[model samples]
Structures are given as structure tokens and as C-alpha cells.
Target chain A: MTELDRVIHEPARLRIVALLAGVEEADFLWLLRESALTKGNLSSHVARLEEAGYVAVEKSFRGKIPLTLLRLTDAGRSAFGGYKRAMKAVLGKG
Target chain B: MATDAQLRDLEQRPQRYWNADGIPELVMGLVWIIWGVALLVGEALPPGRGQQGYWMVMPAILVLSGFGANWLIKRLKERLTYPRAGFVTYREPGRSARLLSAGVAILTAATLAFLIVTGRQGGTEQSAAPAIGLILSLAFLVAALRQRAPHYLALAGVALMLGLAFGALRLGWDAINWMLVLLGAAAALLGAWRLARFRRCNPPSVEHHP
Candidate 1:
């Protein structure tokens, strides 16, 4: 059985990364809504993932509006994939 | 620990959100209507300089319609959907989905060709009628299932009924052409209605992203 990465084991971050896995990139607001996380909660979880190099954040402007874009880095994708396999392995035994 | 299906469902949420507005339906409906009209025009032209030339036009029309539909969807989404919902880029469909689409296209084309060729021996309208209904309804049914929109199933039922009526009446060679036009128009109308409803419910965002 593969070991799960600590960065993605937390439920909130897990949900965030799982949602991001479906798309190429999503704006910050989109992630917040989809994750059903409060603005502050989402921000901190995103920050923690960012610190671990599991998520990449780009702050930019779309016209005058400040836009924050989010996507999983390659490392993040690998970690998520590993996490999924480990969980599946455990589930199969159970 | 969340199961794979749970995570997969979570992954699918963003895609479902993007599609909730039914912008793709509007694009698809318009494309169908335009293509139907172009085919009708081809059938109308007399066989000679214009008709021979029109064969060339059919390919061009198909190509142009593809480009136009692609552009229209992006423009419509940017203006109507993106702001209200925020931005998400869906993953391109995987190989199996692409293969399924291609298979459907080929099957439809083959079936239509068979019907037309066989009908030419008797009557074009009579033979093609049931196939038209089957094809149209199936197309709509697939759309309904994929989009999880029940209205498409209703549309499919309508298409099926119209096809049977057309076959029973045997309205002649041009009957299927008119049916196609009606199908296109009906699709466009339904899509527009859905789009209007979507707009009414979800106003544009007032907040800038953090």
C-alpha cells in the first residue's frame, strides 16, 4: 500500500484538490463556491497547500477586477493520485 | 477516507456547475438550425452550374458552421456565464468519449444513407421518416442523459412523434428537409428559454475575487 501524503490528507485540502483535478484552472471564487468553504477558511487552506507546493496561485487582474487563479501543480496531482490509490487499497481490504 | 466515487463526484461538480447555464445547448441548437437551412438550400438548387457548385458549398458551410458555433459558445459563455459563476476550464473529454462521439456520427450517417438509398427505389419521404425520428430522438435523448436535463427527453419524444407522423403522411421528397428545420427551430427555442431562465435566476457577480 502506498503512503498518503500529509499535505493532502486533511479533509478540506483534499476536497479542494479533488475539485481542482477536474479542471485546468479555476478562479478563486469558483473554488470557494465549489468547495463550500468560507472565504477565510478557503484562503487559509489554499495558503497551506501553496506553502507545500501542492497548489499554485496566481494573483492577477481580469480588466479592473482582481482575479486569483488556482490549479494543482504536477506535484499536487501526483500526491492526489497516490492518495486515491492508497485509499482504494485500504477500502478493498476492508 | 473518502472513496474514489466520492472524490470523482466532487471532481465532477465544477463541470456540472459550468454546464448548469445550458450555454452549450444554445450553441448546439443554433448550429443544427443553420446546418438544416444550408441543406435545404442545397436541395432547392437546380442541378447545373449552381447545384454542382453547391456541393462545394456544403463542405464550406459545414466547416464555417463548426467555427461559428465554437466562437459563439465562447462569446456567449464569457458574456453570460463566466461572471456569474466565476471561471473554470473543463477537461477535454477523454479518448473513450471522443470515440463514442465518432462512432455515433458514423452510425447516424450510415443509417441515413441506407434509408435514403432504399427509399429512392420507392419514395424518399416514406423510407426515411422513421429513421429521422429515431435519429433525432436518440440524439436528444443522449443530450438529456448527459446534461441531466429532462426537457431534452421531452424534446426527443416530440422528435419521435413528428417522425412517425411524417412517415404516415408521406409528404414527399422534401418532407425530411422540413422536419429537420422544425427540429432545429424547436431545439433553438428550448435552448433560448433555458438560457433566459438561467439568466433570470443568476445575476452577475458583484464581488471581485480575492
Candidate 2:
């Protein structure tokens, strides 16, 4: 598994990555509410991962309302795949 | 599964987002100018202090404070963690339309109010500075709250308005001007610190959707 894969192993970040991995982009509020994580918690994790080039954050407005959207990186994708494979291998299912 | 792959793909790309910092400042500055003009007119039509020449200082203070706030914020952009959030493509405002409308509304109301009230004008040709500043600052506050944007600019506006209004109403005109100066200085200093912090961390480039 790659270094990017290892970072996503954290449960909360993994969940974040998992959520973003599924949708084109997830609104920050939605993610925070859905993930049940505080702003600071999510931000710190996202910041670390983003700095590591595993995720991207976007900021814009919807009408007058500000929105934040988060997405993963290509490296993140590769790592996530490896993580899945490693998990499967450990489970003796692959 | 196909769904799993889709989710993974979604995570890997950048998305577009918006930053409201510029718009708020722009609105705040415009409103400040309007308030200054109103104060000048109000001072002109006053019942007292009409050629006292002391009232002239109010508009000067307003102009200086408003411009100073804007300048400080712009210069200190590097220190603050200004909020930048993403909106869906359908959510973006029509190019500059809402802003224009808001500006027109504010100007019209302020102008009408100044003309109608000051015309009868029995009070101590009191510096309209406090009232005008309050209204203008409130405009920024309303915009910031409505937009669900960052609070720094709005907070600064509120603080200035409150300081000036309360100071003028209670302590007297001289106190209000000095209060504004102090408030401006504080905002400038805080903005500088935030800008310094912002500079240390390069913000992520937001993507444009649609």
C-alpha cells in the first residue's frame, strides 16, 4: 500500500475520504453534519490530508450562501484502492 | 462495485468554491462613503453647530475609518483564515446583479431619509456621522449574515458602528470621533496579524463549477 493509503486508514478521515470518494464533491456542512464531527476536528484532519496531497477543498457561494466542498486526490484514490486490497488480503478473501 | 468506483472517483478531484471577502469589503466601503455624504448633508442642515466648523471633522473621521479598514484588510490578507467555501453551480449569483441592487437600495433609502429628516432638522445640527456610520455598518452586517459568510468584516463593522454610535450618544461628539480612530487602529492591527497568518499558509485553489 502507498503512503497515501496509510493516511486514509484513520477511521474519521477514512470516512471522509469514503464519503468524498462516492460523491463528486461533498458540501462541508453536509459532511460535518453527516460525519458528526466538529468543525475543528474535520478541519484539522482535512488540512493534514490536503497538505499531504490526498484531498482538495473548494470554496464558493451558492447565491449569497458560502459553501465548502471537499474531494480526494488521484494519489488518494490509488492509496484507498491499496487499502481495500490490503484489507481484503488480510481477511484472506483475495 | 460501480457505486464504489464512483465514490472513489469523486474523492480525487478538485471542486469550485467562492470567497466572499472581496464583496463584503466592497459593500462596506460603498456604504461608508454614502454615510459620510449623509453626515456632511446632515451637518449642513443642522439646528446647532452649523458654522461651528467642528462638525466637519465627523465626515473626515468616517472617511478615514472606512478607507482605513478596507486598506488594512487588503494589506493583511495573508494573516487571516478567511472563509472560502464551495457552492454548487446553480447556487452562484448572477454576475454582480445582487450587489448592484443592494447598493441602489441602500443609497436610495439613506438619501431619502437624510433629506426628509434633516429638512425639518431641529436637533443640534448634531453630527449625522454616528447615525450614518451605524446605517452603513449595518448594511455590511446584514450582507454578511445573509450570505452566511465570514464574520470578521461584519464584526468589525458592528464594533465600529457601536463604538461611534454609543460614544456619540452618551459621551458627546468629540468622544465619538476619537472612538472611531481607536477602533480603526485596533481593526488595522488585528487585520495585520491575521494577514500574517494567512501568508504562512497558502490557501488551496478552489475549482469553478459550471
Candidate 3:
């Protein structure tokens, strides 16, 4: 059995990563809404993912309002894909 | 942990997000209405070089209107939608996919235009109106299925009914022109209503500085 990627194995982070995989890039608020995570909780998880080289974060302004944008890095996508395959294998559905 | 199926469903979120505020529908509705009106205006013109000139300029006007609609939708979404719902950009299609789409669109448009023109000139039974209806209905049906929006189903029905009604009337160019105008009006109103409801339900989420 292939070991799962620990960074994305956490429930909250898994949801966050799943949301990011759907779009090219999304703002902080977008991720927060979709993932149903508290603002602070999402921020912390995103920061951890950034440290893991799984997600890329870019800070920019939409006019005067500061926005934090996020996307799954290439490594993150591959990790998520692997995670899915592993789950499928475990479930006897692969 | 979500099963693999749920994760696949989550991947469709962006498409739903894009359709949430009805901006795309509104834009498409406006395009149909504008084109219908332009056709009527061209018909009303007295025959001369001016009429010929209007026909030539009509395509340019439609192209410009398309660009205008694109700009308006983006501006509106940025201010009205993103602040409330959230902001996400979808991936663009690959070059080959885009080229294929463009080719098909051109071919389809050319064929439809040719049929309508020749049918009118030959004074044949006006079958083009029903064809237009069928095409528009299919488009709305696709939207209904993809966006999970019930209103689009009504739109599909309206288009089909209008097309059949016009075809039955066999009133030549006038029937088709009127059908286009009515369909456009219905779509625009529906889109506007959906947008208003979306705005009412979702007050822009208070921006929390992360």
C-alpha cells in the first residue's frame, strides 16, 4: 500500500486542497466559503500547505482591498491525485 | 475523508459558482435581443445603398456588441458577484480546443445564415424559424442540466413553443423576426429576475482581512 501524503491527509486541509483543485486560482474568501472553514482555520491550513510546497499563495490588491489568492501547486495536484488512487485501492474500487 | 465520488463532484464547484449570479445568461440574452432588433431595423430600411450599407455594418455592430457584453459581464461580476459569492478563475481551454470551437461556430453560423436568406428569397415555407427554435432550446436545455437551474428549463420550453408557433404561422420573415425578439425579451427578463434574487439572498460577505 502506498503511504498517503500526510500534509493533505488531514480532513480540513483535504477539503481546502479539493476546492483549490477545481479552479486555476481563488481568493481567500472564495476558499473560505467553499470549504466551510472558519477564516482563521482556513488561513492556518493554507499556511501549512504553503510550507509543504503543496499550495502557492499570492497576495495582491483588488483595488484598495487586499486579497490573498491561492492555487494548488503542481506538486499539490499530483499529491492529491495519488491520494485519490490510494483511497480507491483501499476501498477495493480501483 | 470524502469518497472519490464526492471529490469529483467538488471539482464542479467553479462552474456552479460562475452561474450563481446569472451574469452569463444575462449576457447571452442581451446578445440575442440586440441581434433580433438589428435584423428588424435592417428590414425596415428603404431599399438603396443605405440599406446595403446597413447590412454590411450590421455584422461589425454585432461583433462590437459581443466585446461590449464581455467587458460588462467582467466588470459587473468583479464588483457585484465576487465580493459576495467569492472569486475564482477557471482554466482556459487549450489552443486546439479553442480552434475547433471557432471552426464549428463559423460553419454553423454560415449554414444557418445561408438557409435563412435563401429560404426567404425563394418564398419557400418558412422552416428556418423552427430550426432556430430547436437550436435555442437545446442551448437552454444544456444550461439547465449543467447549471442545475430550473429556470433554464422554462426557457427551453419557451423557445420551443415560440419556434413551433412561428413555423405554424408561416408568416415569412416577419414570423422569424418576431420569434427572435420575443425569445430575447423572455430570456433577458428571466436573467434579470434571477440576478435580483441572487443579490437579495446574498448580501456581499463582509470582507475579513485574512
Which runs of model 3 end up more than 4 angstroms from their true locations? B121-125
DockQ by candidate, in order? 0.69, 0.08, 0.73
Model 2 misplacement above 4 A = A1-94, B1-99, B102-120, B124-137, B153-183, B203-210
Q: Tens digit of lDDT per residue, candidate 1, span B147-173?
A: 566778877987898788888888765
Docking class for candidate 1: medium
Residue lDDT tens for model 1, A14-88? 999999998988898788777888989899999999999989999988887778889999999988888888887
Residue-level lDDT tens digits of model 2 in B51-166: 45656776586667666766654443322322222222222346698999779979877884775476347453244446545654675476555454454564547565665666
Candidate with more favorable, higher TM-score: 1 or 2? 1
Tens digit of lDDT per residue, candidate 3, span B1-210? 688867877777887888778887788788878888898999899999999999999989988988898898888899888988788888787899999989988998898778877886887648777888898899889888977776889889999999899999887777777877788788788878889998998888767557
iRMSD of prediction 3: 1.3
lDDT, candidate 3, equals 0.85
- TM-score for each candidate, following the candidate numbering: 0.88, 0.34, 0.91
State the TM-score of the second chain for every model. 0.85, 0.40, 0.90
